[model samples]
Target chain A: MKHLSKVALLVAGVALAACSQPHLDGSGTGTGSGLGEAGSASDPTSVAYFNETIGDRVLFEVDQSTLSEQGRLVVLAQANWLLANSDFTAVIEGHADEQGTREYNLALGARRAAAVQELLVSQGVASNRLKTVSYGKERPLEVCSQEACYAQNRRSVTVLTAGLSS
Target chain B: MKKLAASLLIGLCAFGAMAQLAKAQSGPLRIEITDGVIEPLPYAVPDLVAETPGSNQIAKDMARVIAADLNGTGLFREIPAKAHISTITHFGSPVQFADWKAINAQALITGGVSVSGNELEVKFRVFDVFAGQELGNGLRFKGTTDGWRRMAHKVADAVYSRITGEGGYFDSRVVFVSETGPKNDRKKRLAIMDYDGANLQYLTDSSSIVLAPRFSPTGDRVLYTSYETGFPQVYVLNVGSAQRRVLSNQSGTMSFAPRFSPDGKSVVMSVTEGGNTDLYKMAIGGGKRVRLTSTPSIETAPSFSPDGSQIVFESDRSGSPQLYIMSANGGEAKRISFGQGRYGTPVWSPRGDLIAFTKQNKGRFHIGVMRTDGSDERLLTASFLDEGPTWAPNGRVIMFTRETRGSDGVSALYSVDVSGRNLKRVEVTGGGSDPAWSPLQ
Candidate 1:
């Protein structure tokens, strides 16, 4: 009960902080003075900020690896975040919806990951700081066997890891 | 007559003196399984007469396994033990043909079991009830007490071959991906089991994802894809030792769908480099990889012909995935699947006469078989999701993965006869998919 109350208090505090900084919601206009409190959405260079504010993933059409207009924008934002956060390296995980054979899905996932890597490299993100892995259809963000869930499952996620200076 | 000669040759090779004498005395009793929708041949397998104390339970269980094996084929129907009018009390007992024929049983199998310590000896004889004569000489299989199921399978294989004129597949094993957990976070491990889903052993843990395990032609090793390195790569595992080594480990590429050549000396698999997937062959002993297909489109799931001369693979180079045939080495290829549906996972039959594949059409999936030239395409099964077909060693059956639809959907192993009869789920613990039947062992 004590730990729960403490978590509630922390949530309330974070809510108050977010309400005060309404203009810092990934608008790229905030002063670069919030990097000290890393690992929070309020901190511009944190992983959580990159994941929620900048968007660390992109979805693909059925049986396609070509990026959409929105997906390209997301990748472009992700590339910018990676360029700013030099201490962090990224592992781009490729995935596919469970509508194809296992082997084909693996290849498809690889293609999707490669597409994201290409975009990031084109945007000045160092190629050496990025690695790619295809999870195929083995992992899914959604489990329902419908277009709604499949669209979410067919995605590539950019996961960031710290302390990889190389 | 040529087919019959081949059958007799197989029977003679399996059951030496008895088949020769039976070939001379009377017309042979045969069940042509290919002839569509015939009545199930009625057969009776009495519990083997226990020749030693404490052997009665093993005797009954062994006969049960044998009966189940034969009945599972969809070609034979068992005349239940309760329906038997005459029971043989001794292994040397004479014909009860009149009683079996009265029950309309065309075939009768009688056996005896003797147990000593852990050593078990089982002997059985098959009789053509209508002909009032033995179909072949009595045969015996010796094994440990723990291997009673295999001994029974040996009996069933012999009886099935004698009747169906095809090599028995009952004595084989299958390597497959055993699955667990829920849909989004499912965990998979490599598992091996007997053809009838017994004696299961895990070849790998569920710590990492594994898929599509294919047995070596000799059944001593297995090839499968694993994400141990966080990238999909092919690995070869020794079935006996549980030792595994990564086979394809280029830094920036991913490889999967590996199958052994007929000689088991080389493997052909799909490898992805720079977003383009193509088929490549590599030696089992580690050598330079040979590129077989250089198409810009995805090409994977390559299966070798029984003769190891040609390879049949699924490629989407022509817009949608279709079956194609090309030389084992790099060369020009000819498209074989021209059907409306998309075809993938084209596995050549061990007999070299048919290619089995997974087809998706009109919002449904099917397990289908076609001739080498892609003619005479026969869809064996249709479901919400059915894919990754592996042929039985005899080429008379195909086992594949079938998954249900929904958020709670799960995958399981199922098999069907080549004639599309006897579609049944294999009784596996937990869930399973991607079955690769080893050659008859």
Candidate 2:
């Protein structure tokens, strides 16, 4: 009980500290500060801040890896975030909606992750700092079998790694 | 994988002479079997006589295993032993054909067991009840006590061979990914076990994700995909020593779904360079990799035919996944899947007659088989999630992965006969997927 209380106090202290940090750092005044990986501690410049506030995951259509207009805009915002924070490297994780064969979905996931990486590089995010991996249909954000859940499951997530603070 | 022919010299029984005489006079009372799933032939197996102390329990368990093997095939029905009116208390006892025939048993098997130190010896015979004679010469198998399951499998193989006139798959092993933990963050390890899900031995720990373990033609080496390097890569493992190495360490490249060629010296798999995933072939002994397909679209899940003349793989070049066939040397591809569903993971049966695959259509997944040309498609199973099919050595049955739905979704291994009868869940200790049946051992 004592250890639990200590952890609770530490979490509360961190929460208060996060609430005090300034959030106006991005080149364009967006909701997120466009932080690096270290900013996941609630700093505005952390990619974690970008993910939670501006969205780092983009959903795809059923069995299709082609990015929608909204998905394109999401990737563009991610590209701009990466451009503003060039010190942060990234790995895009591609996933499927669990409606297909394991092997095909794996390939589809690869295509999706690659699509995101390509778009980022095309927008001037250093290609050398980016890598791609397909989690395939093995990982899903939603569990329900309906289309609503599937739409959520079919996604490509850009995860920033190795921040400038390090 | 060698089939032991019933050599008449192994039998010490005097009935060997009588069996040859009966084969000539009565033309061997073999039951006629058709392709259709007919009523299984009823058989009776009495508890094996324990000729030595401490052999009593093993002898009974051996008899039960043999009975379970035959009865599980949907080809034989083992009558309850309690209904028996007569018992063979001695291994050399005379036949009680009338008692077995009265119980509607078309066949009867008698076995004797003796244990000495760490070794166990078993002797068994199959009798055609109506014919009033033994079908073939009696068989004997001796091994260490720990090999009791194999002894039982050998006995079942003998009985199944005599009855069905086809090779038995009882003595085979399967390499699969044993899954654990929850659905979203599941962990998988490479594992080898008996075809009946007995004697599981894990080859790798759950530290790294593993998938789609395929056995070589000789069953001594395994080709599988592992995420140990933080990406999906193919690795070959020596089953006995567990010594493993990555098949291809190409920088910035990812490979998976490795399958050995028919000759066992080469592996055909899928490798993704940059963003395009295509099929590639590499030598098992290590050499320059040969590219098999050059499509910009994803082409993967390549499997060799039994004779190594062709390969059946899945490609999405048409914008949707479909089955395709091409020469072993790689060239123009011919699409085989014309059904209304997306097809992937085309595995050629060991018998070289059919290709088993996973299909997705109208929100349901199926494990199906088709001819080499994609004709005569038969959906063997339909479920919310069924995929990753591997064929038994004899091509008589198929085992695949079946996952449940919902937040608590879990994957388990299941098998069904080629005739779609005898659909049963393999009793694995934990969650498992991607089962690859080894050739007979």
Give me the candidate number with maximum TM-score. 1
Q: Any runs in candidate 1 off by more than 4 Å, and if so which?
A: A1-38, B1-28
Candidate 2, residue B21: how far the Cα is off, in Å = 11
Query: What are the per-residue Cα lDDT tens digits for candidate 1 across A43-122?
Result: 89898898789987888998899999999999999999999989888878888988888877888888899899999999
lDDT of each: 0.84, 0.81
Instruction: Compute DockQ for each candidate against the true complex.
Output: 0.19, 0.14
Per-residue lDDT tens digits for candidate 2, residues B160-261, read 887777778998898999998876578899989989998888889898778899999998889998878877889998888788999887766788889999
Error of 1 at B147 (Å): 1.2
Quality of candidate 1 docking, DockQ: 0.19
